[model samples]
Target chain A: MSTNVWNGEHRRIHMQEVGTRDGLQAECAFVDTQDKIALVNALSDSGVAKIEVTAFVSPQAIPALRDAEIVMREIERKPGVVYTALVPNVRGAERAIDARADELNLVMSASESHNLANLRMTQAQSFGALKQVASLARASKLPVDISLSCAFGCPMEGDVSEATVLHWSQRLIEEAGARGITLCDTTGMAYPSQVARLTAMFIEHWPHTELTLHFHNTRGMGLANVLAAIDAGANRFDASLGGIGGCPYAPGASGNVCSEEIVHALECMGYDTGVDLAALIAASKRLPALIGHETPSQIVKAGRRLDLHPLPADFAAIRERALQRDAASAEPRG
Target chain B: MSTNVWNGEHRRIHMQEVGTRDGLQAECAFVDTQDKIALVNALSDSGVAKIEVTAFVSPQAIPALRDAEIVMREIERKPGVVYTALVPNVRGAERAIDARADELNLVMSASESHNLANLRMTQAQSFGALKQVASLARASKLPVDISLSCAFGCPMEGDVSEATVLHWSQRLIEEAGARGITLCDTTGMAYPSQVARLTAMFIEHWPHTELTLHFHNTRGMGLANVLAAIDAGANRFDASLGGIGGCPYAPGASGNVCSEEIVHALECMGYDTGVDLAALIAASKRLPALIGHETPSQIVKAGRRLDLHPLPADFAAIRERALQRDAASAEPRG
Candidate 1:
């Protein structure tokens, strides 16, 4: 058991900013192409490890992200920051490759019910399509990220077995030759125990696979899950700026965990996320106007813990004030 | 080392509703007496272990809770629920006893700067006053809860040492006979490791005392702090409805953890809080109208995790819709 989660050798925690893709996809209003470029540029400058820039899906299906190609091409990519894109199939992968995306992300659900509801595909069909996309990705010398949606638990199917996730993971690794696998709590049904159990099993089973955990704060346990996963030694995780992403099925739930909150919590607990929270929050200042509403950001409302509030000039003379008030009240004059 | 925080031990968690006192005290507008009565009555019916009905401070100092007596007398006190009140001095204790409060709560700051700013008295003076109040409470046969504010950290004077907290805790126990000691993160500067370390020391040093934790989400770790405290074997906590409270010193900070969110998170993790979340949330629904503002409630926004959304009528036929749409788009438009 990894008893001390933060006290081991220097473990570099990586945060993937997914606001540009996962966050804006759920918005009713379309974020302009120039705004998308600006947002991604700001995130890149915030020293995030990776940024899921956009999704290369059918424009007809998700019109909000129709500018994926332009967003992928127009952004000024930094040297160390890896810009990734979500691709649904070979066609999207083709677009992503053409657009010079650094990484390609593919997703399929572990539960058949969710597979049908979310992607309009069966488990077998999704695997076949992803296999083809994986072949294309391999031929293009691009890395693949397979995000098994509902890896924690499914909304339609209450609990997804670990064996199912492992089986798909094995297929994605061997058959699709994938490099990374993301266990997504698509509907926020994950608890710390469940997260710890799965993370330990994944680490023991697939030692070479780069595992990432995607969480939604639908149940408000997102940061706790992060703590649990880190305790189990899984390094990479997905977070959205301002906590803007949400599971469409779980209406009214928080989108993803707030990037600033997660980074702040980890840094406080002595883990180095290497992301500057002040710069990230300064960038978050533009979100309300762009999104036309307040983002689910707690740090924006409550400044950093060390950011001191202004005290009255007479704070040191408080006893004198009290004594004077008491003396005045004791006098006989009204 | 408690490796498994959630073991087979049948641990019962207790939540104290402080919205009426801690939450409303910060409100710019006064909540009506009838509404206060209705709110406490609703909280009582929801089966919370304790509800801080009001603070018996000077009306001139805090006019928001000036109708403390009326609220206390009017609320339909549920059986098995402890209704507590905050009393700062001998006069406040007398008023609390007159109001028939079950418990009297007194507070002093561990940091002298905070002590001066908040109470207009030195630490020694505050201790003397609280000792007198404690004697009064002992005569009236009422329990006393002494919350050491900034037990974690203070804004003006950063990094409050654990020695300061332990020193005050010992004084409150030996000198004032405090039955309950709350280690308060008065400015939201307490981290999880600090919380765990202090809680363990307190538990080991004072086995007879009931230790409760009070957290502010000023830095977005309020719920995370709850998890840490629970891991350290603490079961009692203070939370407010709708996340209504804020630190007057820490502007734009969240006052208390949202009651429904904490209850919901605990119940999800299989801990029995014994409070009805739906019922508490139902009561929380009226807070917006009473507070004249939107609340920072996640459960209010997201609903319960088990609350399933309405599925599309053509959910099962999603594949067919996609295939048909694909086929139609393949053919050229007329």
Candidate 2:
């Protein structure tokens, strides 16, 4: 019944762009390595806090990101932006380190079935593997962040328990020495209330650790869930450029939370996102040609809320007729 | 700064469907009269609190709803569901009353330029005409509700002042004998903080009056704005089936807030929307066939979050291989 629930705190929000890794991995046409570097370079100037540049998995495992090492080594890195790479094992970690990534991002699913299905390993095995990757990253003096996929729910397993998610998060930090954890809604199964509960729980348990909330717009609750997480004290998020990435299980479904749309919304709501929105949108505009497909970004489709449309061609005539009608009606009906 | 901002109050939300009127009015292809009746009947069973069945405008103005009278008279009205019709003037009010509509919805824009462009009348002229329509409805004992379009922002005028919106709302209620008001985001310009401020202001000024929030998903902030309005104590919303009706000024943009998606979200968030989500989705699925185009409803495309997908075809083999791999990796340091 409280009406004062609008948190117009104007706090800082950390936006992480994941189009190169999470988004490109699902594309049907492979983007040229130079284009990938260009995309990352464009996003770098947009003031995003972090950028997931590429994944160092096996070329056979994910051929789209086969040029990950080259991409990591060649891009003009911005000073304030943290350039990260998704690493699957110690070998991947060594490659990322050699290529000079700012941070090492490791991945596993909170649900057991998703872990096996996605990574061909049980939860325990995946944890063991990621632990070694984390250890290698730590030994190389690099910060390691673990992304726990399906933290909300799994398409194969339905609902993954919060206890299971928290358990893995605790281990990834306590044992693997991960400095941060990302709760990823891998299949867009998270709703706002669930997002609020989980975000609050995570922030309460680990106040000092870096927390990022990643969502997909698969069910159209992406922005709503973002607001809920922000209300529950989450300041970091993962977004994809042009809203590209998550494969549509059915036609017309959306992908990840769009970077430009999220930045636009946060900026409108008085949040300090540190993002140059016009610059971000310009980069998003090239996604369709680069990816050979249209993206689900609403901002890219319909410009920002303040972007006014020109008056209809007959507007001056229409106004004149309206005034004449009003004057004639005032005089009285014959 | 405040983490306890998620108001998970299990309140009852009144969902009013406007697809048959606001949505269909903008379509290039006209839906058949019988089909409109069928759509209304289907939604009647979905437990929505109200339905804007049709608009009683001149066939010249909106040829799409030309058979409004026949459609209204033919539809099987359900008990406990109010059937309303959009009435632009006294003549429209008379026709709506003759068709046995339960309520009359009068509309004008909060912005001057939008009013002239959309309704071909200045603000004062439009108010005078609607006041007469409201009087006619009052005489017939049918409740009159005013819908103020562009209450958030005007597409041509940029930003509509809140003072103008509140001024019109006050006149429509205090002078025009209207019982309810709907703040319409005609071109999807509303953001959350703006929605929060306006909704709270309206609730504060008119605590006893019925208030409905109408939104478009043009910028993908429709549901986020809905959540913000709810936090500010709004209970009624106007949604369109299949997210249809708004003519896309740009390609790949959405129209109105989708009924099934809103019901699905509120139900997930523990609010009692009293809508059968499956039945609503069933109706939304029929939109493409009836309208000859795909709709923007996410639930219609991807199914509900709880609706799990079948495991991948090679899952059993993949699981066996994964187990063996884990077993092999457990024993080794070559």
Candidate 3:
């Protein structure tokens, strides 16, 4: 209800396109490094302020992102685009920094069970790794953003309390000196009320820290959650082009919230997303063949709401003529 | 934020499953009448108060719905489940009445251009036909529910004003004696603000009439609009299982809002939809083969948020054994 919440003056939320890295990571076949670079370059051209290029994890751990260095090097660095990479530890942070990433993203799972299962580390160990990465990025003069995965709910731990998320967020801000913090509904177990409540709590507790929302469409509440976050004064969001990501741990967890769909929804509601819907759809259309399956974006399948394919004026005349001819032919007099 | 609004005490909104009618109509291939009957029977078994069985339009216009009669006859009607059908004209209404349909759904497009293009009739003519159909259904002691298509916006005419929608709604309720009216975003152009504004306007004007909000996911604001409508005191909604159905005239328009998605969103938010999501997903899975295309419903692809597929405890030992076997086989000298 607050018109000022989405005005043009407020620093526009920078949408970070993560389809190339997180999206392609879950594909059945390996997307070549060149294609991944091309996708990132295309996203850069779409006016997205930030693009997560790739993850700097062990090649043996994630074979899909083996060519992260090549992808980072080959991408066309647009004038104002901030290229970021996901880093697991100090070694991964060094790899991202060496690749000249404009920003480094460190993720620590909020759920202890998920942290242990995913990063093979306890909460304390993961926090130590994050601190080390943050220190290294700071030393290298690279901006650091920390994403707290499973902030809303964890697949392993049935329900994750909001207090845990807020506490970790505060720690990430104070201890690691994270420049920005993103709360991830990693398994997409977020309800709209929960999103609104949690986002409001985060904003209230840490009013100065830059906050972002990373929601998965795993349970179809991605856009709904985004709307809730918007209501809670959250603007920055992480989305994948064509909703193209899957959680390796959570089987059947499909894509991240489709970037194009989010942009379309926000722009239509009179919010300034700074992303072109038509160009975003055009970019999404190229992914199905490149990824060997259809992207789950609704905007890609159905064009914009006002998009019309008008029938030519003479089409009815032609049909009428054909009908008249058929009627004449069917007459008995011949 | 009024809990009493959706507390299911004074007023409760009912969902009429239109999968059998609208869902089947959109499919290119003819779903077997028996299969339709089975689906309707299954929906009847669910706690949904109403099930729209089939449309009684001309077989020449839509061959997909030719077996409406058989589908209506075969469905096992439950005690409180009201079986309904779409009646385009007096003839269709008569047919529906003869088929023992509990309610007759009469449709009239609010936009004259769409009405003419889709129904081959002027707006006046369509209303005249609707009046006759409503009268016939009333004479037969059958309930009549009116659906105003393009109530929010039209494909031909970009913006359909609230005045036009309200005028037609008033005409249908007062002149035609329609029991209930559904405002349809046929091309899916309505925003949340628009939905809230229109719903508040309608409820204020037509305090005694039953109001239902039917939306499409063409622009991906379907659920958001539903939430807005609920916030504005609208109770009833029309949704298709697996988000089936599209307007033939509205090019590139996507399917109806998925029933399971809506139900899941509402239920998780503590609103009672009176529909089982797991059962709804089970029903939706049978649709791809029947419709000859994969459905766009998210719940079918990724189950509910609380749905857990926990790994068997012994599976970890099996994975460890496999890892050891691979490591041993990789040894060169041994």
Which residue segments of model 2 deviate by more than 4 Å?
A1-7, A248-251, A330-334, B1-9, B247-251, B329-334
Comparison by TM-score, 2 against 3, better one: 2
Measured by lDDT, the strongest candidate is 2
Candidate 1, pairs of clashing residues: A245-A255, A246-A255, A252-B302, B245-B255, B246-B255
**Candidate 3 residue runs with Cα over 4 Å from true position:** A1-11, A29-35, A74-80, A248-253, A312-334, B1-12, B246-254, B288-293, B312-334
lDDT at position A161, candidate 1: 92
**Scoring model 2 with DockQ, what do you get?**
0.73
What is the alpha-carbon lDDT of model 3 when measured against the actual structure? 0.82
For each predicted model, how many residue pairs clash, with residues at least 3 apart or on different chains?
5, 0, 0
DockQ of 1: 0.46
Ranking of predictions according to TM-score = 2, 1, 3
Return the lDDT, model 1, position B275: 94
Which prediction has more favorable DockQ, 1 or 3? 1
In model 2, state the lDDT of residue B129.
Answer: 92
- In the range A32-148, model 3's lDDT, one tens digit per residue, is 778888788888888887899999999998899999999998899999888999998889989988999999999988987777666656677678778988999999999899999
Model 2 lDDT at residue B14: 96
Rank ordering of all candidates by lDDT, starting from the highest: 2, 1, 3
Find the candidate with the highest TM-score and give its number: 2
How large a fraction of the reference contact set does each model reproduce? 0.54, 0.84, 0.35
Model 1 per-residue lDDT tens digits across residues B1-334:
2446532134689999998999999898899999999999999999899999999989999999999999887789788999999988899999989989999999999998889888888788789889999999999899999999999888888888988899999999988899999988887888777787788789889988989999887777887788888877788999999889887765665678889988887887677789999899999999999989877787887677666554457885886765676678679998
